[model samples]
Target: MHLHCYRWTGRGADRARESERRPPHPAFPASPLPPMRTCDWLLKPRTRIDASPATVAEAVAWLTRRYRSAAESFLHPDGEARIGLDLRLHLAEEHLAGGVDVQWGIWLRGGDFITAAVICCSPNRHAPHPCPAAS
Candidate 1:
């Protein structure tokens, strides 16, 4: 008989990539930089907002300015996103020519911290390291 061990890597390192994952609970880093690692360095825009926006619309606008394009099929005739927070807005998420899944989203933690990012989730399983699409 044999036992197999699973290395319990951080979900961010697992196949289902997301910006939602954060450091373990209760402890907060004193560093000014956003708590980012791995693919984030390879994916997001250079600007990161450390302060929260006054409203969801503010956040949406910030993300929109960074990414001017959207998946036409996912948006309205006005080029706005189908989903809404309190009212409505546009979100950018689309598949690249090579089948790369590109997604943009906002990360929020209370009224003090909020930021937006764009990540090109590897076409293959997992992140760039174990991903066949990486070269």
Candidate 2:
């Protein structure tokens, strides 16, 4: 299952932009922004399919491409876009970490579309030795 998240910027929206340029002062109060609406989190292509390795690889590629495009977009003109930050694949899930399941995080943003912070949990853990039964 894909977990989707999103945010929108109407006219006079600059909170996302300001946050990046300057670190918030310790005494600065938080802005009370309104909650995102249901209609805002929609995507054009709504086809469902198996999320196999191939699909994931494609998604990764898409994220990578978007990153470059967005970075360029932000750099041009008056130096702005609704997209403040697109942190795709925030953390790498290394099997080196000791655990039964691998865990990771993602972050992204897209207008009128769901930017999912997708996490994958592996059923199998890394083992130095093969199962005794197999041996």
Instruction: Say which candidate scores most in lDDT.
Output: 1
Q: What is the TM-score of candidate 1?
A: 0.23
Candidate 2, 26-90: lDDT as tens digits: 22223222122212112111121112223344444444444444444332323323322333232
Distance from true location, Cα of 134 in model 1, Å: 40
Off by over 4 Å in 2: 2-54, 75-87, 90-135
Give candidates' CA RMSD values in order: 16.1, 14.5
lDDT minimum window of 10 residues, candidate 1: 1-10
- Which window of 10 residues has the lowest lDDT sum in candidate 2? 41-50
- Show the colliding residue pairs in model 2: none
Q: What TM-score, computed on C-alpha atoms, does each candidate reach? A: 0.23, 0.27
- What lDDT tens digits, residue by residue, belong to model 1 across residues 31-129? 223334433323222232222334433444545543343222232424333344323233232222232322333322221222233333433222442
Model 2 TM-score is 0.27
